[model samples]
Target: MSDPVTFALTVLALLLGAAVLTALFSGAKALTSVAHVPLVIACGLSALLAIFLVSKVAGADTPQFVSAPVTWFAAGKFAANFTIAVDPLSAMMLAMITFIATFIAVFSSGYMRGEHGEPDAGYVRYFAVMSLFVFCMCGLVLANNFLLLVGFWEGVGLCSYLLVGYYYDKPSAAAAARKAFLVTRLGDTGFLLGIMLLWKLGGWHTDLTALFDHIAKNPPPTEQITAACLLLFCGAVGKSAQFPLYVWLPDAMEGPTPVSALIHAATMVTAGVYLVARCAPLFALAPDAQAVVAWAGGITALLAAFIALAQTDLKRVLAYSTVSQLGFMFLALGTLGAVSPVFAVVAAMFHLFTHAFFKALLFLASGSVMHAMGNVIDMRRFGGLRTVMPTTHLTFLCGAAALAGLPLLSGFWSKDLVLESLQFGAHSGHPHAGSFYLLMLVAMLTAGLTAFYTFRAYFLTFWGPTVVPEEAGHHAHESPSVMTVPLIVLAAGALFVGIVAEPFTHWFSGFVGRTPSIGLAAKLAGAAEVAHHFNWGIAGVSTLLAVGGVALAYMAYGAGGPERVPVPLAGVFALSRNKLYVDEVYEGAFVKPAEWLAVMARVFDLLLDSVSRVIAAVPRLVGVAVRPIQNGLVQFYALSMALGLAVFLSFVVFRAGR
Candidate 1:
């Protein structure tokens, strides 16, 4: 096996083994106490392997490395196989995911084990499921074919369902799990159909390389390509939590905070963005699909930011922030039609890589706060934690700064790439340039909103006078070294990962651009838009917006602006606070109607069952009516026989006379 292949399989084995072993020993506290050891090792090994593969690929003659596929099944021209292929894009994802997961595992050990170092209930089960989720996610990223990808894709979703409902006894947790599963599956259906369409259109090849080759050789109609691409985007929309399908994500905070970090940052949500980036060839050919991507992402970004402005729950604020940030990624992707496919893919992926670090940091930081506060996360319930938990307060501030796109931070670099991409798209001479321009404006507005909400949450949680809720007694303090250490490491990532990657040098862009599919996408796009690597104007505008937002947030929350809303703006506050009633709209538009249909179907089924019962009674009624004739009496039988014989003789005489 090649290096990438060996590393991929080994990582999978380690995680799978850990999951099984931890599960078998869940009842044994002694055994379960050490479960996180294997997880940390496995995740850490994956991170190292990913970095190694990325470096090798960057210097290799080929853009990717693929191992010999092991065929699972075959019939004539169709076959499904297990294959591992690593490219710049997947490698980047691997590095980000596993890196964050390693820290998360370390943090979880401290988290699941109480602050006093005693193992909490279900500690072993938690690690077991967490390992399984990482395994599934790695498989999804390493998959070489659509068939294999979809398998791991569903596996990731299944693991997400389990993780989100970790507290199965809690009704909210269970319901949230179901909602996440069902909603994502709705998009997965479209994704599957799209895959099948592509298979048919691309000469029955499920291997991504072969499929792309076939499509390039014998191009499908533009409309067919567009339809397939759009269908695939449906899965992205749901998994990434955009618009109508986004309801599940906020509710998913009912799970453990670590689970939220994994789902929202590294694993489940990122899958959708990965899918779209992986299939750039198809989307590049479909301008209409690209436009749709851009529009959906822009609208989602703006809407989620607005909603974030009014949220009170600590994790819910970050949850909406994740939704909004994902919108930014999609917005970058939507610029595909207006710029080089390589440029757009790199821009979106760069953000994904950077986002994993800070988002995970913020969530884990929230976990730290929850630990200190006896699990009280509502900002309304707790205040003034800066002096109480100094370490957590400082690390959380780093994450918040990055998330707000402060200059020289991780988010600053990546978000500028996204905005720069959109700006290029606006003037790329494409027919949809006008629409792209509009999207860029929306994105600019969203940037300010992002900064505002992020800082607002920060100030509300940590800057006010000390007011710890009753849940947290006088003993509230910083998390232990096991937890805070990871926070510090991740805080470093949030602060420097982008600068180290060197956005100005175009190193990240060049490395990810070597991806074969990205090259193919560029060919399909034709006459690539020539855009600058750094645009000071766009950067300045975005920086100003971010700064302005931060200032506004400081004035509103930190500098003692009115605690209560102004009467004139109360209605707007209500709307934003209520998430613009999106859930209610969905209930009225889709849920209520489906529920009514279900009720009618149940009534119809009962009616049919009644009719069947009446028909079934006929045989019983006939048997009852003939009961007298069936009486077993010897004399009665003889009389009946004599009467029958006399009747027969009369009938015979009458026939003879006739």
Candidate 2:
């Protein structure tokens, strides 16, 4: 079918509606709660993947897609389109969101089995939210209009809030959710403004195909286009969590591990890049806006990479890493056409794919450990878990290697591709690019820091003597195959995805509409082997950095166990320990000022309302004086009417002359 949007919505509607109905009709004991949910999602995920594969390849060149707009309301001028239209980009995103979500769903069957008092309360709630989340992401990416996308965008954000605050009993968890929502809303205003500008520029043509169709024939005024670009960037920054607006991601770890895995790693955070990719034509003409994007993304990547280096909490590190990685994606978008936009987009999207696998793997492995050790995530409370939980330790190590961008891992291919694009970008003379060499140097350094910090976390948690009290759990063992299987699957994906990057790149090109770049060495190696012919020196240097970092971490933290680490760098190491105080700086700069402005708004409203009431009373008091002037007298009314007539005539005469 040409109509991917309609197909996706129908699919989501069926999946969610069926899940709810099953929950109702199956009764409490018949379906056995969350077990039913995982099974249901498995079925839905499989169906969606089948559809995505069939549709993505089928409709690569044809735009004869049918519109199946389900209107929420209809008015003369404004009506909402629950519009779904899956082109290549949308199809690809749908595949990712559903696939990873399904993995989390399946993995959770075992991980979440005993979380709440009821054997499956957490999974049941998680499934409902997760299914809704998948629906939102699919709907968002496939939406044919800005309004439709916004509806689904906000839907995804809403689920982000709910899932983040899933542990409502934990005040910190609830606060983290609030923080994320509030911070994102700040950026969403820009997104809305951009949408409005877009509508204004091309009224009666705001749908995706229509906008492209209109612009294809006639470009809008430069001012309108630039404004739209800025506004969209605002939305992107908010959703993607960049630069000034990125304060919330680190705290996002307060959510459940699976929630963190799904929401942050795979789906919600990538929406911004999808938006940019979908509307690349518009952004292509907005040079100034692209420059802003480049600077913002470059600074964010460099900044967040360093912050991630200093974080101690396992998931927080990944949170900052996600933010940093997203910056790299935006940076590529900024340099569009410099090095084929298709290549950039493919690299970014592939990174998104690989990051989802490895990041989710890391989070779930950490979850296994936390479950084993009574929810202890502090790296210092762990050590030498190679024996106790071989599966988790090995899985974490594999995920860590992938994340560190070592050789043939999925992350290595994607990340280096992004960097290579940035490296070659400036030569193309796009105003959006900077000195490629400098950017490459900066990127290389960031890679080193990323490797170091990631390995530090890995080593402290699983490579030394057991720092966990010996009595923690004699049964502290490997998780079930349900959990380990997902890890294995992700690890396998992470390992070989790079080796086959060429095919993935080819598959991804169905969206970006450009031929994939052929790195000669890569092609010669045939996508089946790791070849280091072109940039062997860079590879050796970067690899050395990672290994060195791991060695240092081993010396410092892996001595015996976590307890042997230097105490000075422990506990109240709030600055380095808390990620270079970036959060504090943000609080001091933006959050506090916003809070103050809110307070001022409240105070101003109170004062203005009180003054307005007092002014209103004065008019009433003056009415008493006027009443005395005309105390029940028809003669007084007649005199006042005559005076008013005379004044009106005089004013009319004066205005005519003037």
Candidate 3:
């Protein structure tokens, strides 16, 4: 009955109610005008609750509020509970989810409206599913148990599938939905298995706090913990769109733009990072798993950035950018985990927070662009939008600068923390210093690529000659105030959120209960006294790289530049443009084999059916042959009985003779 718990319950209830109400009234035209009312009320209440919880936890030391565990099912020592907990981490995530989701909902109100300013036909359903999406994420952040988290995790996945394929009639949209669903399911299977393994190996308890306490008090074997952590990371890889499983995310752009923003920014994709953070206790015991996570993240960041460089579609560029940024977060987690487990979690969380603002801003701004341009998202066809949509142009520029990790932007602060964490690991006398150095190199290169591609998209979209398609040219104009307002708010966050980096990192580190140790890099470089100080050298290197990238982009795509700049290595550009044929590789390796197995299964099924029919015919044939023997006549029956007796006597005599 604590205030925080009460507020959280109230928030959950209101969101649940809004979801139910919207779904109930989705198909009712008469209620379309009022469908958003419940969501508005729910969002407002949730925002207030989130703020209250965050304020309560902001200054408190080790502040954690947990609801009394309600046993859902119990047999012997095995049990599952319905519980909720909010510490600084969960509270922060709750605040961001509610706050960002509220604005996105408001933006959608304007964006999803019909051409004539009426509500779209599926308007109610859109709001309904969106509200449900928010509810699921809330459940996830508040969940105190693994089972609950998994439930909410799958709930968000289901909602994403629903929202992504909202336009069911569009073949691409439907396919994208299925792709996202099946691909994530692959990781989800691993996640589920990990949970089961943890339960079996550690204890029967599924409560996260309890499980962490158990694992910490009585540490398990390295192999067991490592296997569990790796399994859990598989889910993260799929959900966050890491290498090999990342193909689904770019295609997910087929959904409505708001849905895309939600996925990329606030909700599903970030779940993997949160999972790792939540399970830091486990990962701390599994160094091998931690290395795998870090390597996967680093590799993904570089690969996705390269792909983004060659993408022509606005959303696809952003999608790949999201994948790359997520990789950066994982890399931070992995590197820090090696040097300081607590710092790794904090660093990753910091990036996740900043990324939410800038990435969401970028997506919404792109939506605004699409709105004005009659849904044309091809950057090749867009140019000089700054002259027409100044507000959107400025807001989008803020987002782009932040994403590029320009000095003082939100991304600069977070991304540097990641790099610094790597530096700490490289010089911390860890056995894997060489590997950390290699990761750092890749991360630095990815940063340059990020800046290059982001501004490349920006310059192509807003700075060149005004050259929109003829069909959309006449209609290009600023988006409505509703949509632009969110952009402005998010842009402000992207610009100013970096200022709180020190306080936020300090608070988060304390909350997680582990302070990062100073690495040997400061000592080796003869700056041990200022080891805790900001690494100006690292910052300078990253900034120069970013500047160099932006300059290169300008030279290539700025006003009056070449129609198509000749790539130095045309084959490399071609490969990048084709996503290095990763999809084709998967199709040939996995998909084709799966399809062949399915065909073989179908042929086996047909053969089995034919054999079964042949076996079945014998009984039918016997029945048909014996049908005439059952004649209805008392005299015939008596004669048949007498003949039978005579045959029996004959048979008995023959047997005795034998």
Candidate 4:
């Protein structure tokens, strides 16, 4: 009902509707350069809407939900409503979705320039779907109730499937799309169950406010609460691409780079973090549930980080890195719920913000490289690119520094808060504190792994000798300004976020809480470790690990001095290049098992047929057996019928007769 909500929702509707209209009319322009105008305008407007919400109302109170119940279904004294809301959380997410969509839109202006062809149908289609994806994500985040959220979630998931397979003609893209959708569905099923369980809790309370109120009044059975948490986490694990559910993401690079950047890096994956943070109050009441969520999140983070250590493909490495960072956000939320619920939520939100910028920058920078280098992502095949693509190289370097948590980078500040959240966990009740300690240790291990892989990626792609393939010889150059502009903007964001993170943390603290303990320990630990060990502790260790990884790559590839790639590191390079066969393990464990099940489906069908055939024979056999009794004994049958009728009537009439 407020101005911000009305403006935001109206703009979203206008964007979507305008896009559809433009797409229809676009066919008349022979689908020329002008087709992009509508899309760019919509994206810009969307950004304006988001900024208005963020600047004017993100810190403001939640708006009362306004709904006109469109009858989705009516059955047996119940009706399903297509309800919507503009709460504080939804407003935040709405702003984020639109903002990222705008950046990606601007980047696409250059990245997808030559992609347009005769008829331009495909390009037009791309814009349409992209707009829908934004719409669905915004709608999902703003839904006041579970039913609406589920609908919106499914829409976003489907849009992701479409976007990931944007180059549908490519076998790789198609495969990746299928893989992503199927795996995510595994989690969505649980998400659906969680919704159902919530709906049924205390007699069909599906509205978020109503559900929370009921939970406050009559806390759910522990088993039900645990199941709800796990189910919701099923969606989280799949969306965030954590551990066993993570394989589809790296392969998703088969899509266009911008597609990968938008869906995997900037937007979709962070939905899980938003979900957990939104429900912090409910999770706070269930410590065991929180523990499960925290443990799963922590384990997932460590697994992905270790795997990232071995990757060689530039985008693939970043893909896994996204998964790992998301896991850290989850870990923070899951652990800090009871002790510092607000801090956990704020930290998670902040991490989500910083990660979006850096990760998207990383992907776009890689796109610039691929654009110049004949679509090659094999970092071992590149060298001395700083001279060739200065703008891109330098911008990417800044992005990497952010990702590696280097000082004064957005990643450093956000990542520090996440780490400190674990320490907060450690000082809770003794049992909780002990659990948090182990979790923090694992998270720290992930930090080391993060540095190792990020640097490995940087070194192979940027440093080392000039080993450009013959076809790629002397063709590399700076990308057009359109792409670099977004990269520079994002890089600046990444740099500035860290320096001002304290104030931002303070601002978000009003919604969550300012984390005094995390800041204390973070500063203390860094200073202490630096004083005790290297002149630089966390930063020093991280930089050294990164440099060491680069050095290792150099020895293994290059033959030239000071710029040598690794020749000896070739064989052992499989450790990093093959991602340590972790993807293979995932295929064997989950993928292969699913395949095996599919293979046995025919046998299962045959067994089912056998049972069905026997069931069919039973009815016939019973009918035949009874048919003999109905033969020509009519008088006898009539006598029996009369006797039965008399008894039946007597029993029925007894009370009336009396």
Q: Lowest summed-lDDT stretch of 10 residues in model 1?
A: 557-566
Each prediction's Cα lDDT score? 0.88, 0.71, 0.84, 0.71
Off by over 4 Å in 1: 529-532, 559-562, 623-649, 652-658
Q: Estimate the TM-score for candidate 3.
A: 0.95
Quick one: best TM-score, which candidate?
1
lDDT of 3 by residue, 1-658 (tens): 4478887888889899999999899667788867777776788779888888877776565477789989977788677899998777788788888888888888888999866689887889889998999899999988989998999999999999999999999999999999999999999999999999999766776888777767766778889988999999999999999987999999999988999888766678999998887777777777788788999999999999999998889999999999999999999878644566656666788889889999999999999998888888988777899988999999999999999999999899888888988888787655566799999999999999999999999999999677667757576888889899989999999998766655345544454332111121112112222123468999999999899899988888787222474767577778889999999999999999999999999999999999999999999999999989788888988998999999999999999999
User: Root-mean-square deviation of each candidate, in angstroms?
Assistant: 2.4, 7.4, 3.7, 8.5
Global lDDT of model 2: 0.71
Model 2, span 433-481: residue lDDT tens: 5655667677777777788778878877787675564445555677778
* Tens digit per residue, CA lDDT, model 1, 1-658: 4576676677778778877877888767668788788788888988888778777778888878787989978999789887888888888877778888999999999988775688878788788888888988988988989989998899888888988898899999999999999999999999999999999999998989888889988889999999999999999988899876888999999889999988777678988888999999899889889999988899999999999997889999999999999999999998886899888988999899889989999999999999889889988777788998999999999999999998999999999999989888887877688898889899999999999999998988888787777787767888999999999999999999998885667778888888998899889888474544677898899889889999998887894222556699788878988999998998899989999999999999999999999999998899899887978999999999999999999999999999
Better of 3 and 4 by TM-score: 3
What lDDT score goes with residue 532 in model 2?
18
- Candidate 1 lDDT at 279 equals 93
TM-score of each: 0.95, 0.83, 0.95, 0.82
Q: Which rank order by TM-score, best down to worst?
A: 1, 3, 2, 4
lDDT of 4 by residue, 1-658 (tens): 3466576677668677756866685466555555556666776787777667655554455434346556677687656676666555565567666766777777776776653223333666677777777777777777767777788788889988888888898888899899899989988888888777777764576667666667766777778776786778788878888766777788888877887788899888887777766665456655677787778778878877776766657888899899888888888877644345656666677788888888888999999888777778877667667778888878888888788776667887777777666776776662356788888778777776776677667666776565564445566678888788888887787778555645434544443232222322223212111101112344555455545544554454334323233588566545656766876887898779988898799789999999999999999999998987787988989998999999999998997888
| RMSD in Å for model 4 | 8.5
Q: Which one wins by TM-score: 1 or 2?
A: 1
